[model samples]
Target chain A: MMDLQVKLPGLNLKNPVMPASGCFGFGKEYSRFYDLSLLGAVMMKAATGTERLGNPTPRVAETSSGMLNAIGLQNPGVDKIIAEEVPFLAQYDTEIIANIAGSTIEEYKEVAKKFNDAPEVKAFELNISCPNVKEGGIQFGTDPDMAKEVTTIVKRASDKPVYVKLSPNVSNIVAMAKAVEEAGADGLTMINTLTGMQIHLPSRRPLIANKTGGLSGAAIKPIAIRMIYEVREQVNLPIIGMGGIETAEDVLEFLLAGANAVAVGTANFQNPLVMPEIINELPKTLEKYGFSSVHDAIGKAVFV
Target chain B: MRKVEMKLVYARQIAEDTIEMKLEDNYITQIAEPGQFIYIALPNFTLRRPISIADVDREQKQLTILFKIFGRGTASFAAYEPGMIVDCIGPNGNGFPFDTDKMEKVLLIGGGIGVPPLYYLGKKLKSKGIEVTSILGYQTAAQVFYEEEFNQLGETIVVTDDGSYGEKGYVTDIITDSFNFDLYYSCGPTGMLRALTSKLQDKKGYISLEERMGCGVGACAACVVSTKNEQGYLKICHDGPVFPAKEVIL
Candidate 1:
């Protein structure tokens, strides 16, 4: 049997595939389609200090091979998430990685601190790279200093491991990676959606309500692979790579590009069963490429 | 919702820019409610198009989706022929509530392509022996469909903007106090819904909304609508494609 298991910081994943944060809500929606335990971990939606209603309607626009979204981090507050969502997720055997976000550093720390009491949360994915929100999301992501500062604060407040998500919209991605690593981050999730927009020809205006949205789908895979390869070369931290993953072959590509585990984002919208289908196909894919296990494929394409 | 490779049994244009597609081996039809929708994944498109289920013949194991070509994704449906497999996922979102025990006289209002689901809804309500009065609005006579089918159920009135068919004005223009429908179910463009809600203030009714959607399963909050409650917002893809008129702000 091929060993699909992988370990990263506080997560001992049965497989390397998981639904990316924001794409997979709080796990209740997907649990109806398939078993949640089939996944390595469930990355819950980004939670803030207070409940946010998010942006207006017409938040999504379809492009060529991708779609743009400006959901603005609509979620129940961290307290409700801890009280309600966490317990529902606790019923499953999978590890829970809470994605914490806020508009201010204090809010970030406050959200992280609240999850400290919830034992179901195995790790925290510091969402400093969400492109949809106007405040606090990509602000800290693009700037090296703010990225490092927020990482330090969130890491200090949480007992569980913190994996800082990196934005692709930055000019110096290596600097951002190094900044978070220097701030004592446990790991990294590279390449959040690139800021983009679409125009309705008849209306003669931007299609999305926010005027801009994050671009995600098969279009962003090459960019994610490139970023993961670049960041893996500079930092010695485990990476959870994602951008536009949809297939098991895509999973193998990210694993070879230096991601310890991979997350499935926009693809879930296309096919709800995509994650498990990819998981089922992964062992054969790994075997077809002559890799004995998941860890064996990590960074194989990266030449020092 | 289970994903299945549904085989296209047939495809034909029901009206101008509108086509009716029938797919078989659809497990979704067995449990699909009238107002629920399905996501159809097309070639080269990043997102699936959420189409309302127009009707279902469970014994024959067939389901119908009637849509108008508004975008490239929907336009591609016309290219599909018999025996072709279409990837789909659904019976998604809540359908119009049809509790026959409480409802006696019901009004079904639909506009253009929005008129399809009401046919199935009308059939179900008619089966329960409830009186159904339908107000179907179309841009012109060329765009009208399912009028005869709705007529078989009960009284059905068709209205067009240009007076090309039936009555002369919008569906709201034909509505009067004489109908006295106990409840209403409507699916249409936003303007019609707004006008209907305003005309019938504090009346108990349900309206299905349309928006650009990501995941039809409610994971992605891409298709959210504002509400009058403290929860503030609800996802249109999951929480509803159908909602009680008074609960939503728009």
Candidate 2:
């Protein structure tokens, strides 16, 4: 049997299958379908210091192979998440990666510091690259200096590991990756949805409420894979790869492409049990690739 | 939620542009409730189309969904036959409250495609011996349907914008003091729900919402609505396609 265990900084995961933030809502919704303990880790929704109402109506729109969403980080504040969602997730035997987004650096630092006291929290997935919101999301990710600044404050605020999420909309992903790494990021999550939009031909209006939203799913998989390949080549930190991951084969491909683990984002909505399905299929999948363990497949594309 | 390969039992043009379909499946029907919806997987379409549950025959293990041929998905659905098989995932989201027994003089109001789920809600309420009064709205006389089925349950009132039907104006135009209703349930476009909430002051009500959804389940935060309280956005898919009329902002 091949070993499926992998580690990102100080956090250890039994398998490399976890749902991306926003796709999995604090594990409350999916728990009704299946036990969340079946997966390696749980990445909660993007939280901020204050409660956000998000965008207006028509937040999502479907595309050819994927969908676009402008949810605008509609979380119930960091305190409520800690007081409510965090304790609920502690029941499952999994690493809890708290994903936080902020309109300002102080907000990021406040969220990081607040989560620091929770022993159940395993890591901080710093979201400097969400395209749906107007402030403090993709603005921070595209710029090297801003990305470093956010990473620096977050890393300093928390004793836990900080994995910075990268935006695929940027011109140079490697530069962004190196910037965060240089700013003392423990790890990285590459390719957080490409910036995209669709228009309603009949009404002559934008499909989503935000007009332009972040696109994720089978449509963005190619871009995510390419970015992971490029960023993985330059950054020595462990990378969490995601985008359009719908099957076990997709997970193995990300693993081969140098991701320490892979996140199933848009696919989770289609099938609630996708994480368990991928985790169950990972062992035999690695065997087919002639690898004894998941660790053996990391950055294997370089040798190929 | 289980994905059932539902055999299309019947598909008929119920209106000028709408088609009511009955699918033979047991996966979601056992758990299906009023105001809950299903995600239909159409051939060649990557994303499943979310349609509300119009009615269900529990013993027959059959559930019905009504769709208007507005887009490619529904256009394809409109062309489906009686023998075609479709994949459906449901019964998704929290349905309307079947447990609340406080309201006696209940009124059900809906507009356009939103009128269907109210049919199920009306039926369920009537089964409990509660008096149900249904008010349905359409753009014109040709777009209206379910009048016969609704009449069998309780008082059925039809309103057409062009004044070709029972009432001359919108559904809310007739929902004044004349109805003397203590409870109200509604579903429709954002403008209608907002109007209903404002017009039906002092009356307790529930409104089912329709939003562009990612997952018909609560996993995707796309189908969220602002709540009246400080909670901000609440998911329409999970928290409700149906919510307390006073709780939701619109």
TM-score of each: 0.98, 0.94
Clashing pairs in 1: none
Going through the candidates in order, their DockQ values are 0.88, 0.63
Residue B171 error, candidate 2, Å: 1.7
Give the per-prediction TM-score of chain B: 0.98, 0.96
Off by over 4 Å in 1: A302-304
- CA error at residue B33 for candidate 1, angstroms: 1.7
Candidate 1 lDDT, B137-225, residue by residue in tens: 99999998998888898988999999999999998998888778899999999999999998877679999999999988898899988
Q: Candidate 1, residue B181: CA error in Å?
A: 1.5
User: Stretches of candidate 2 above 4 Å error?
Assistant: A302-304, B1-5, B43-46, B83-85, B98-104, B164-166
Single out the weakest 10-residue window by summed lDDT for candidate 2 chain A.
A266-275
